[model samples]
Target: MTERDELVPRRRRDRRGRGMRGPAVQPLAATGHRPPLPRSRREVFDKIMLDVVTDIDARWSEHLGLVEYAVEDAPQLPDDWDSGRVPLSSLVRGSGTTPTRLVVFRRPLEHRAADRADLEAIVLALVVEQVAELLGIEPHDVDPRYPSDLDDD
Candidate 1:
């Protein structure tokens, strides 16, 4: 073999086994900025839920004592379910010595929302409606931000 052939470096293999891949340097690492936080859809939904619950509790914590809030991936529906649409949330009133529980179904709410802002609106609306039911008051009384156009029917 010619010396010239030996002097030429062999090309590095990539993911495809064809050519080079990946960035020369990771984007944020080179800039001296910290990496962005990693969050999943469920995490995002939970944060939104926490914000809404905190706001509602500030106003009605006295009237609605010992309430439990939760976020589930999706609700279990029976085969004979009659509703035209799936439920985005569920509320179970507590009896004597039991705390009331409110559950937000994350998948259904995420599916119905078009974007982040819409998701926030939907979460707020559901919480307001549930709180209204618990307190036996209008949703508007529960939160002025409750969407005016949301239909109860």
Candidate 2:
């Protein structure tokens, strides 16, 4: 072998091997922010709750004509039933053109799911249900339907 060839470094092998793949990540959080503080189950639920809220804002802020929306953390509940809880309560206080309110019970929703996929489905469903209820429309109206062209594949 030539001295120049010997001087060159060899290509390193992929650590995960040929066909292995990592889990897909959703754009759940902002960039360059402090890592979320998830000490208890509530914190975990809070993070997921925020994701759902953000998704709503991204998808329907203009359509809903919403100036703003908030996701209040679920109040502390009994430890025995707080792992993945999501409780929903709504109120119409103002006399004229009352603002919409959506409260997501974090602990109960989290408890209802067995895994991340389940958690995502539950969160999306909860958001859809709440938004639909607020708008007095069917839940399907709030859900994002796939384009018909995608079904042609």
Candidate 3:
């Protein structure tokens, strides 16, 4: 036979170089439960915040109930804001018929963190700071584990 007549199509090759032609199929794991996929970054951030809030609430039930927690993608920096200055978080005081609110900027915090542990620490600290403000106390007083100076970053 001529070279062209004997040639095999590129798509038909199998591991053993046999001309087995069919669609590829993925095999399912034999294990009863496959591991869950990792959570998205925003979901992880939300979970970390929720865990922190739950812990704080359990310890300080009286003050935590009146506060509302929220997460925004990022802070709205003013148009003329100075260079090298950005607000990572904020706390809003309640008005008539409104509850005090703590807002944590997710993007900024995620950008600042080097890893998941760092992100958790930053989130916890921000919550502690906002809770402290609402309670008219120091951040450390709100959570003894809070860093002495969270101002470094």
RMSD of each: 5.3, 12.8, 5.5
List the candidate numbers ranked by lDDT, top first.
1, 3, 2
Q: What are the per-residue Cα lDDT tens digits for candidate 1 across 18-94? A: 54433434465555665567898888999999999999989999998889999999999999999899988889999
TM-score: model 3 vs. ground truth: 0.73
Candidate 3 residue-wise lDDT at 105: 89
Give the higher-lDDT candidate: 1 or 2. 1
**Candidate 3 C-alpha lDDT tens digits along 1-153:** 678767955554476785443333322343344456778988999999999988997887786557787889988888888879578778878877797788888999999999999999988888887787777888898898899877454
* Candidate 1: residue pairs that collide: none
Clashing pairs in 3: none
TM-score of each: 0.77, 0.49, 0.73
Q: Assess each prediction's global lDDT (C-alpha) against the native.
A: 0.88, 0.60, 0.81
Order the candidate numbers by TM-score, best to worst: 1, 3, 2
lDDT over C-alpha atoms for residue 66 of model 3: 71
